[model samples]
Target chain A: MATLMDRVITSKAAVLEGSRAIAEAVRLCRPQVISAYPITPQTHVVEALAQMVADGALKAEFVNVESEHSAASVVLGASATGARVYTASSSQGIALMSEVLFNIAGLRLPVVLTCANRALSSPLNIWNDQQDSLSVRDAGWVQLYVEDNQEAVDTHLQAYAIAEDRRVLLPTMVCADGFLLTHTYEPVIVPTQEEVDAFLPPYRPQHYLTPDKPLTMGAFADPEYYMESRYLLDRALERSQAVIEDAAQRFNRAFGRHYGGLLDTLHMEGARTAVVAMGSVVATLRDVVSGLRDDGHAVGLVKVRSFRPFPKDALRSALRDVDRVLVLERALSPGGVGILAAEVRAVLQGQPRQPAVSAFVAGLGGRDIPVETLQALIARAQDEAVEQGFADLKAELVEEGDEDES
Target chain B: MKTRVEPAPELLSPGHTACRGCGLLVAARLALQAAGPRVIVANATGCLEITTSKFPQSSWNVPWIHSLFENTAAVASGVEAALKALGRQAEARVIAQAGDGGTADIGLQSLSGMLERGHDVLYICYDNEAYMNTGIQRSSLTPLGARTSTTPPGALSWGEVRTKKDMPAIAAAHGIPYVATASIAYPPDLVKKVKRALGIRGPKYLQVHSSCPLGWGHDSSLSIRVARLAVQTGLYPLYEVINGQLTNVKRLSYRSPVAAYLKPQRRFEHLFKPGGEALLAQVQALANANAAKYGFPPVTEGAEAEDSD
Candidate 1:
């Protein structure tokens, strides 16, 4: 007779189903509290876990909060009291919870959140993109982007380890492409329960409510103290990159899976041309790299994983050898260049012999980016670098009349 | 030492920077006394948060946290939840305190959420009628015809045109276990309400009329006297709502006219000046209506223990 754990494992191998993989990963982490609200695309992640809790597959306290703000607050409260807490939201849900998001980080609560990247609403489009997470880039969270279902599951498991590390007791966001990574089905290899238990330990709050050792978690800081409080938070965030790298390295050794660093470089060896991107687009870029390589083009791809500490040194190293680098951003920074483009440029400033970095602001508001378009962008950047040297390149829309005349 | 049932220890100590005779200080001290030492206060960004906690200093003897401008209820809810999870629920009581601006305007949503979720927490709103910290800006709870930084007395307008927000009624609408309005002038009643709220099972809201001298433009020494005048005039009536039903109104003896409350504060001075008698009359009418609705019996001179069913 098989045991209960075996009975639940109908499909033994790792499945690459989008939201299910995320749910499975969270289950592996075994969070004590899960507070969530229903938001489009992101709802399935929490809903699946809720069902698991009800079905006795996951033993957890699933708090059905009324709004996104309360959901974040519930998790913060639960996490502060030393319970491992998890929550998921998207788009306006994130915006609604923005005030508490800063408090959670400022208080240094190690809560793990999953953001199903979606567009902020005015016309209310609930689909896929990076606008939501990028908008809160200054919120002092360790942001990690996942390329696929496997990474989504793996990253969430790793997020807990990194976030709860004594040196980096801060909140983290596991950002996945909405619908693309949330709804799509794929094969994912889930680790055994015993293996996961060994990989990630139980949460132990550094400064929780204890009668034996009384301490204040969040206190009012006046002008003289407020600046130092913020400075400490900034220092903690800057120190998280090393913690993330160490956790990822340990996770790889234990599970036999390797994710490079805060920034991951791909096919950049001896390449003078590259396209820098994040999230699901990295998979598309990998395909583009293969197509370009088959056509005898020296092109590579760079994927940013840790977005908060930003991995400036790693990015500089990745782009140092490349003569031309094209940046693809899925979110706009309004009147300025795209958020990622601005950050990459800031990192490259005054560096020794930098690449001619060009920006392609595409796939915004859930707009799909085909492999063909990504290839064309790479080709355009190479041509622009050859013609304009190190001059900045903007997206050039192809005129319809010109194509018709041709 | 005087023998008394109340603990003599000062939970909210002296040397704090509340204005002379500031009713908020008295209310805070009495409420903290009633709550005792094992209390965790979640203070919102307001006058209390500013004056009590000024960089490497704190007036509270109990553990406290000062969250953002709003969401003290939410933060308090978290503290309660944390305590419950840690199996130390009985060790301390969670109390969220904020000003009228933070409570009635910006924090209503979070407060509602806390009450609806049935968290074991007590929220206190120190109602000084305006945003005292941001230089006395008009807030939702600021009474009508009061001159504030935002609602100035101009040629076209007398002062604030809108009446004070009915916060206790709104809180009662949340179906909380206990909801009450108390004045700093009635310290014993305020302390009793605080003790009652702490014993409740679910969320409780106490709206205390804490007089602000700077915002009201009153003589600093007359803050408590002004607060007492408000209750005597029936402008700021003391009442309690239990389980969504009105009960136990502290009807004063010898109910004074609205002028007794209006004359002392410069914020309400505009209502008494030239062509402002209409606004004053409107304020009087509102006070009468409140007294009648809450069954506030007119107090007679030297008469005590007035009660009506």
Candidate 2:
């Protein structure tokens, strides 16, 4: 029998759900505390984690919190005590934990959370949408959107290294699209125990809640001091961009696979128009862009991996010379524009050659953004002026609001 | 010549922003004193957290953390889990604490989770009746006929109509090993309970009846007096429920009328007003019911003025 202290990792390629892949990767990281409440799409991840602990496959505390609020809180507390801790949630679960999300980042606890991105409820959709994580874009967590199960598994590894770095002690959210990534089965290569251990070292925190070295955490800041504390947190997140890149490089060195630093791109070179998006939809965009490039069209794809710390400089350089930038997003700002589109425009504003940024909202509330829809949207972006609207909207279904006039 | 008295170093330092004669502070000091040096406190956002940790200054000598208002128990669960993970559970102890609102109301779920999961944590609730820190708002644990900002006595209502939520019973229902009630009025008893709660292995609860002079409408000097009166009046029983059984009770030798516990506090002043006789009797009946339930003596004629101690 393997003792409690034994750390074991078995690397293999298996057809697994994104949730199972994430759980497997998390086990490789060997987090000391895993706390989560069951939410649809995000349930399988926590369930697998619970099973791992139950079966003695993982040496960790699987705290069965009553709600997602406590799930986040439990991990936050565990992280403050200098333990590598993890928790996962989706949609309303993420919304319920919104307060503690800011608390975790503000306190600079290196908690890595998996946000199985799902739509917010009114109609109560349980499928994929990036709105949940996007809504809290200003909450100070390092948000990394993964394009596939392999990337989701890989990002979890990079998330810990970036978050636990003393220079950038911020919580990280590895966002994989709900249902699309979390529920879909795909071939994922699990990193070996040796590879994970080499890539990410044991968490050695500079400041932690320990009796041996007593200190205070999460102190109440008055007006005079609160801004500066926030400033420090903001700066730490800003500084994390470099650490993200470094972790990715190191991850590639260790595992022979690399997800980009902050932002990743495909065929952006010498392209007149480019599609910029996040999450698994980026993979769909990649295929569309590849097909267009083969048909002798100047089109490319910009996969925004890091949504927070907004990758301003990388984005500026990527879209500097492009004539038209199609910002396809799964989240919207209701009255305004696509959440990622607004950021993309803001990032490219002062560049030497600014692109005409067009906002396109897609895949909201688990709505499908099929390959034909992407082709149609790309053709429209190439032909039309800079615009913002639902890319795949059935015009007949949307009311023109003649009632207001009546 | 004056001889200087040397005391053990305080785990909770004296300098902070707690109200003068604040019973929560007193309870915190006693609990920390009992738990000794090797402890980590996960305090919920309340008077204790605000007063002790005002950014650049902190009153906690031991490792302390203050998360959000309703997640202290969950945070303590994490701290305890981490300690266990590090194999330092023997050396370090975890304590989670919150005020009445943070404990009995908003924080109940997390506290239940911590207790149900059997984390080796000592969860303490400093029940000061109302949300004293937030301008005396009513919490679920606020007693009947008490006037908080939210439950002010008026033509439409007398005050808080509901009885105090039995939080200790709720904790005991989790099948935890120990669930005890203590009071800031009795230092020896409070400290003993804290120490005993810490000595146990699994989750233990110690709810300390703390007074808020500002919120309760009493002089700061009467904080301890009011707290003691609560126990003596049987409005707040000092007892322990261990392993689902009523194991210990600090039986009152002589009891006071519930009015004695109520009249001094501004919160319960409405109960003593004209046309408040029926409500007063109801309050007294609740206290009598507590005495009956906790194995304390029923009040007799002329016994209403005597002290328990």
Candidate 3:
């Protein structure tokens, strides 16, 4: 019930669920239109924003759509009309929105979305995993993964800045681990409206749907022009890397907190073994790496923040001196290797003194990746040639052929 | 002095790829003429979108967007929200449009959401019966006894056995402010309904029966005649359901036989085959029921009736 001025003057940290943190950041960004469908893990984010709109706390239109497909479409339309828009979904919802996700990016709308990342359904599990957002890796959106609640908040504010930059002008998805980040309550410093307004200006799209200047969008391109259009989209995403770094630096200048450009590293100073990961699992990796460094094991952690632009150069340089790089990931290609690990290997391939890049899939379908498993993985990387395997598989818990439960 | 009817400002330019007698384009042109230049259109992926706005060559003189096939209504909701947020709602009206497939089948849920939310937008469905843009696949709106690529008649089966989905009734069920049915044959009526829908504040739906020369296997020049025959036959009735109440029904002065409507199109050519009598009679019975339901004139003997076959 505090006034805007009172909150600005008393800018203090408050304990909040990660979803509420995202909602608070969205409110500060002043999205003119917010649309979303209630899905597991991501529901609370939109629920909070909906309550804020109802209570006159946020002056935005909260469009309650039928499904995630419509939710994404609503935001895409809103964005094309020169309005700052926000939406959120997870897991199956993201899968349902795959078509529209590609359409939004192809149309070059600077809409921002939050993915409360969850495992895809086969067994219909509603647990935390990075598979959903990572599944739409080639949707041409700037995908940023957050490690914790505060980072989730900061990354959202940064997302709007990064997406709306004229040079970028592509949709951005801020992926935070479902249940891990979305359900857990953590102390987060919510920025004031004035500060957010200063950091992120009003969205002024170069091309938009306005009667004053009639324009056509989402027109189908023939083969003659389709490849060039895709090439341009790729260039735009690649250009987004500089904008992402610049936004991070400016965010640090304004808020005095930093999420390193592209990828952030910890304890990589002259370390022989490095563990690469993303999302909330990186927080666990940080703890395990610090312990190993204290014990003089020469282990480090490379937290990949930007997954879409792939942070290929930043990762290559970060893992250049390492003797071995263990790529731990929460998502995999099912028939292939870890999604992030494969990309890491491709980026580090044929480099001078290329480090050994190993793929390790862990914490899938919301399985807890505790410090013991992290330590075991590091030990395996040190002793054996760990190519690509599940990190925390329970052999005794498996009943072979149980998957065919028909 | 002759009263001059100034032609509706051409919002849709000519250099597009729609067929020679595309009933959908005719309906769109008339509706857009009524909605005028001060409108932003959210179009679904269909014949209208594909033909009019091929990349780098758009026929639209108004601001327009074509997203996926099934999300036009939801997209228009976003456009309306954005306009409302920008305080430009008064300057530009919003229209979401799609083919019957996009409206009655794939896009129904999003359409329902847009209507339920009461966004101040007009959703227009150009009902050409089947998925004409996708090489004549059967859609939910494909009428009974008509043939499509997916619903082709064979030795054991009749084509498209299911009745067309009642989309206007579905729109009216949401308790929206307005829901109407129009035809390209009735240009003035279609234009009037479009303008009226745009003048209203909340969600409105207008389903225009647009005949497809290609899909229907009718002569391109007889497109309007075929559309008119549809209305006269009462198979595709022209009416309005306002605020959930049946308000207006365009009465047929000269009621035509269902055969007069169906016999010309190759899609229904099977109905004239040697063993196709019973299904043809069923088609007539449908028309009779529609006429009875909408209070149209009864089928008088020899009145607008074509060949006995």
Candidate 4:
């Protein structure tokens, strides 16, 4: 006689790296279909899963697609028929699948994908950065960032919940830092398959291609109806934010893990200086905050989990008490400050006693950002806040010479 | 074998707003018949999209979606893929329909991706020679010596200096399972080709010669007449490429001269003027070369099948 936990067990607790954690989480989800093509950083995630499927650990259809476009197409087909689907890609792979990515969103299929954040190539560097994920910010998928291996596992479980929620039938992206989280192994508390089973119910597609009940998933919207269709999509996305938060709360109640809804704050109590960041950089910020606190400085950290919903009110409330807010952005918007900084500034507009916000663009093109550098960034932002009082808020780029200045 | 075949009345109706004698409307009707009731169409931004689906009202009787200008094939592939994944392959047939500009020029890359992926989809290009919805712009499928908004006759050059794109040849090169060319002039033949394309397992391409009366500067009644002449003159030969091989050629026993095809339309009026005869003769020679290449066999003495009305 097997126990309830054994009946629900999808994966075992093992010392797995972040990338392998992603592979294992997806395996436990038991995706009926996987379509992937190899690209730097993202290759290992699929490769590990391919080996699992080959070894019969995961019983799923693995499609070795020719291009990123075909890979997206394969998953779109598999998912359209009401099957659980999964895919992984990075940088160039994301760009190649850009067209189909938009289509998958428009068709409203709950396709789960992991983006090992990497730099876009022209000169072709396969290192860590958020350029790929940030490039697809408006792609209409529920985007989430994981700071460590545990979050990677936890979020994959919640992604199915958020994406498959009847009210929010949208695709979800689980993004992690390339090489930083993907290659770095750590101790993660894997939820017993039973816990996951209770957390994530079987996906019952609201609309799918079926002969018994015929419904059109994708229909032509001419100009007259096009704007209205887009309006509906916007409304759906706005509704998804609440759905994600509710799903997170439910997940916490079920697993006893306080997976914060949309966004998470650490050590923001009575702090005058705050640093806003996402992905694996939050771990470095946590270390920096502890070091700063030991030296009698009031510094804190805020980890942005759901970048798509933007969590404007929550972010504003978190930074209200702080006199200085330092934003560490992993990608640049070419002619302006980082995209995140622009979005955060937009949210801070017309708010009472808004903190002196400074934008620091770092970790671009897979450049390494050490904990010492992040500490310097926080210190410089606080100093600038006291001296210049938001005058240097839009600091464009922290160049090599400025490293010593900070 | 002159069997009477009646057009299905349910697929498309007469009260639609398509221009009178519009060949694309005829093509759409035949295509819908072949696709039957369980069909979903992904239409591109073109004349058909604008005229049929103008927001407040839609002329489409079946499920239809209008994606972007160049992504009809990609969208249809998505729909078909989803349907197949859901184990409802026979629930509906996905059809991607676009104009010449959308298919041959702008949407070519996405179309190629869909075909290369071998999606269970049928892509139909209603070749009306120019971008009619955008007002007579020259498209890749526009024939040589045809005057268009972009390719107007001038002192230095004639209209449309380049030859019409060999679309069927290019599609066949993709190694798709089925590829064919048809015209609205031959409704039964076009319908049969559509049915054949749908019956194929993988990606299929069908290019239909749809005439534009307003854009071509011809009498509205001359649309079908001009399309028939195009096929008879070997200017737009009807043929099928099965499994990458040019299997069947829709040959005309006695070919007509290119002048008969060009004289009715104002777009090709320049080809019959002063020194244009020489250019017209060159056009005729090109048609003759095509006939020779496709091996159009001569008709026997008394063995001829009568055209069914």
Which one is best on lDDT?
3
Model 4, span A184-274: residue lDDT tens: 8887777766777777877787665543554444555667677887777677778888987888788778875654678888778888988
lDDT of 3 by residue, A155-252 (tens): 99999999989898899999999999999998889999999999999888888999899999988999989999999999999999999999999998
- What's the DockQ of model 1? 0.45
| Runs of candidate 4 exceeding 4 Å displacement | A1-12, A30-37, A48-84, A96-109, A121-123, A187-197, A208-228, A386-405, B7-9, B12-17, B297-309
Candidate 2 per-residue lDDT over residues A1-406, each given as its tens digit: 1001111233567889989999999999999999999999899998999999999999998888899999999999888988899999999999999999999989989999999999999879999999999998999999999999999999999999999998998999999998899999988888789989988889998898878899999889999999999999889988999999898888877877776888888888888998999989877887788899999989978888998888998888878778998888798788886688888888877777877887788889999898988888788778764557676666566675322110
Whole-structure CA lDDT of model 2: 0.88
lDDT of 1 by residue, B134-253 (tens): 999999999989999999999898989999989998888888899999887777788789999998888999999989889999998877778877887778888889997788987554
Tens digits of per-residue lDDT for model 1 on A188-220? 778888989999998877776543444555666
* Tens digit per residue, CA lDDT, model 2, B1-309: 222222557989999999998999999998898889899999999899999999899999999999899999999999988888777777688899999899999999999999999999999999998988889999999988889999999988999999999899999999999999999878778877888888899999999999999999999999988998898888888888888888779888877888778878878888878989999999999989988888778775445453535
> What CAPRI grade goes to candidate 4?
acceptable
Best by TM-score: 3
The best candidate by DockQ is: 3
Worst 10 residues of 3 chain A by lDDT: A1-10
**Which of the two candidates, 2 or 3, achieves a greater DockQ against the reference?**
3
Q: After superposing candidate 3 on the true structure, give the runs of residues whose Cα lies further than 4 Å from its correct spot.
A: A1-11, A399-406, B1-5, B305-309
lDDT at residue A240 of model 2 (Cα atoms): 95
Q: In model 3, what is the error at residue A146, expressed in angstroms?
A: 0.8
